[model samples]
Target: MTRRTMVFLAGFVAVAIFILGSIFYTKPAPDFAQGIGPGGDSVLVRPHSPILGPETANVTVTEFFDPMCETCREFFPLVEEIIGDHQGKVRVVLRYATFHPGSEDAVRILEAARRQNKFESVLFVLLEKQSEWAAHGEPNIARAWELAGEAGLDLPKAKTDALSPEVDRVIQQDLADAKSAGVSKTPTFFVNGKPLLSFGKQQLYDMVLAEVGQ
Candidate 1:
């Protein structure tokens, strides 16, 4: 082939390859209306789920999270900010996944704090000091307990309540629901019953905004 023809052919091949790669590698967004897995609304939100806004909100953001999950900790503030931006229109319901080592103990501690109306406070503390207590290998659950106490939990009472049948029931129910919801990640989020399949800070915010009609 002539030099000019060869150059043109090579450019055409490169463009074709690029287009084919885009089609094959790009992930299509999940269907929002159909939702994911079984149990439907029952698995998305529960009576025992920790809520962060008015119960009557039109938009519900259900998050399946593990306390010891690094990404969960990072996204905590983002979730809170989204709720704050929407005022009473958006609320977040937290369901435990507890996939990390020693995370069940953290879940128990948070549930215990719930009995005293200190769930949010203790949860904040735990996430803030997560690296210290939720470190890999051997987690320092004792330090987590101490942190919960410092976060205004009644140490003696919280320790006892953490192991109660009620707390165990909460853990079991959430795990079952997470499975039913097909949640395989530490921080799976569903906005208005639509799974956040795109999975990004901006994507989550956009999903919530779309549901909020903003």
Candidate 2:
């Protein structure tokens, strides 16, 4: 073939290859929904889940988190900041994924704290002191109860309440719900039922901002 003809043929082949790649290329599918998850209202939030911020807020951010999760401890401050920025337009629902070894005991303590109307206080205090109680190799669960006491929880009652059947039911149901919602790790967050497009502080912020904008 002539040099000019050969060049034209090569260009045509390249274009065809590009078209084929476009047709057959398989990229990882993003699980995030453009709006929110289907049936999110029912799937994401359980009735007894711990809530932060105003219930009347226009947007809901559901977090599937483990009490012992280091990342949960890290992002909590950012979660607070994002909620504050929304100016009463947002609320957070806490769903326990409880993937870590000793996270269940911590979750039970927080649940008992809820009975005393000190859930938020105890939660914050425990999260703040998480490292001391939630060490990697050896968990110090009693330290969590001590923190709960300081957070205004009735210590004796809390210890009993943590083992109540109601608390056990809540923990089990949350685990089931987390699995149903496709949560396989700690700190899985959904804004208005939509999973964060990926894991990052900025990504979470952006996702919440997008929901708020809508």
Candidate 3:
């Protein structure tokens, strides 16, 4: 069962919960297929969105993820591998779809981590210990802070920055875009703005591979 297919089959149960909803390097400016990407008036790739790989890479994958979603955590390394496989040919654009309980605060922590240049560290830590802090029915918000601190984030500054209006703006933009883009699930994706017509790990891989060839 592909991740997307699995998500599709199980989505309703997850959605019944009333959800919610990374970067490697700089981009090099790869040519994008017209119309689907975050160009013109689109808002997926906002100013504060952390990007990995070169902007110039030919393939860009935009994912709407929830920091608290277990599925998102499962797929993180896969996404990392895809980008790594493509080297500078692929770039990832991450957006929020904060549906899970306590997810908003988690995202706030990530945004703050970005400010402190600890995004990669904090994100991995949170995901690594997701079950501990993001427990399904009872989110341990304080534990998340401790995990972030363990991830090398400067906790005091992270807390202050996480609550900033600027970070709020980042979250707000993602919320608006998620609605406008019709994204109702976490880890929803687009390749250079083109929706993933079908979902699967291989399908996801092929999408970017095809883009790389272009």
Candidate 4:
């Protein structure tokens, strides 16, 4: 082939491979069911599982989240809305997966709040203000303390608890659990122990409904 023709052929081949690789990489993996057993050693830290909703609810939606993940923040409101709408019909279980380095501090702060029985409230506020705090050049522990205060947790105690061995164990357990689940991304979720294939709220709702036989 002429030099010009050879160059054109090579470029075309490169483009084809790139396109094929992109398609393969983005394709969803098959839906596989992991039977519901005890949380056991599979998770780094064992959260309050089957977190009680309506005792009669047939479906369980479990979320594995990182506090510093922007996408998780974006999805938080929607998830909360869904839980509210399905009240008594859906059980939502939250698992900490500190995927980002900054997430460690956030996770510890949350666990500290949990020690004070304020975990849910503090976690919600943290998710709401994640952008403001995480965007800062340094991890803002003070801001986290302020949020804890706002959530009705004693700031001093929360700060002290954040450094405690229990909080450290919780963080370590969460990380280990994330690894066991083969989760590498923030906001990973499971509906009835089956992985969610899409990221949108609508997809999440649909999957939950399907599992719930709604």
Candidate 5:
């Protein structure tokens, strides 16, 4: 081949390589909804209502929990202690996820109590004695009603309200919210809009104190 022709061919090859490299090297478009389901950082932005503690507290602790979960039953006291220690400085929100079929009725009953402004007391009693009602065999609503009665709630009304459409909607919304927030496990906690993977009471307290500048 002629030298000029060879040079032109080489230049063309170089330009093609440059163009392809630039196309490949260009940054990809960002996914605005990435990492948001069962395993993602975007789970923290979802909104949930506070179930305990002061509403105006500086630190918001959101717990995605299952009523029939044994681990959640164990963690209840630790959480209660934390709330007691913090007093008005922390807000605790419980997002009920009905992971087990057994949890459905209990969740509905609790939702009903919530309508009557007796949810906190009822929830505390339920969690404290979860093993009794959540044991093997068919769950006993009568036992649950008795527990509610002990908690100063109107057992008959609570039972009726538990079967209402409003309770069903609340449970459905809780499940949908959990899916949107990427929650897969029970007793997942979020502190000030961030997931808490590992931390003890002191660590949690320090983190909250730092956030509050106390």
Candidate 6:
């Protein structure tokens, strides 16, 4: 073959290889609508995650929440309503995203509360009094602890537990999983492994309804 023709053929072959490689190797865009995208279902729910419904429930609503996030607080009741609406057919798994300054401490307290079987109560109290303790620039973590106490968490024991390595690990794992699952925003909901790409109460409800086949 002529030198010029050989050079051109080699260049064409390289270009063809590059194009084919990209087509075959490039990861496809995750189908968030399916709830089980590139991240898979394992990242969606963990055994340590706090579950709010029957374990055997057909539909699982996984929410990545930051304790100090106002949107998360607002959506708490809406999620509850969804569970109630579906009765035993739906469940919720709460995962910490701790995106705020004092949120890590808040989640520490929440983990402690979970150990004491006061997760829901402490969670509600924290959300209700979020404004008081979760100030924008300077959060009053002490007040948050006090509110947790009021919610039935034994302050002393909880304080000790909150500082445990296990709690820290949980927070770290949750954050890692959140990132892997493409959850950059608090109160991100995934119904039956399908993501609510659009943030809205009605949208989440619809996702749940569709997952539940209702």
Between prediction 2 and prediction 3, the one with superior lDDT is: 2
Q: At residue 196, give the lDDT of candidate 2.
A: 80
When summed lDDT is taken over every stretch of 10 residues in candidate 5, the lowest stretch is 30-39
In order, what lDDT does every prediction score? 0.86, 0.85, 0.82, 0.72, 0.72, 0.86
- Pairs in steric clash, model 1: none
In model 4, how large is the Cα lDDT of residue 26? 66
For each candidate, give its TM-score against the true structure.
Answer: 0.81, 0.82, 0.80, 0.74, 0.72, 0.82
Residues 1-214, model 4: lDDT tens digits: 8999999999999999999998879655533244333343234224443243553455666678878888888887777776787776776667788767677888878878778888888888887877667764566766876887888998787788889987777667666767777788878887766788777889998888786665
Worst 10 residues of 4 by lDDT: 36-45
Instruction: Tell me the lDDT of candidate 4.
Output: 0.72
Cα deviation of 143, candidate 6, in Å: 0.7
lDDT of 2 by residue, 1-214 (tens): 8999999999999999999999999875434433322223465776787878877777888899988999999999998998899988888889998888889999999899899999999999989999889998688998888888888899999899999999999999999978877789989888876678679999999988987898
Worst 10 residues of 1 by lDDT: 31-40
Candidate 5 residues lying further than 4 Å off, grouped into runs, are 1-50, 136-138, 199-210
Candidate 2, pairs of clashing residues: none
lDDT of candidate 2 vs native?
0.85
Off by over 4 Å in 4: 1-57
Residue 5 in candidate 1 has what lDDT? Answer: 100
Best by lDDT: 1
> In candidate 3, what are the lDDT values of residues 172-203, reduced to their tens digit?
89999898777899888888877787877888
How many residue pairs in model 1 have overlapping backbones? Answer: 0
Clashes of each: 0, 0, 23, 3, 1, 2
RMSD of 5: 7.8
Cα deviation in Å at residue 211, candidate 5?
3.2
What's the C-alpha lDDT at position 154 in model 4? 85
Stretches of candidate 6 exceeding 4 Å from the true structure: 1-41
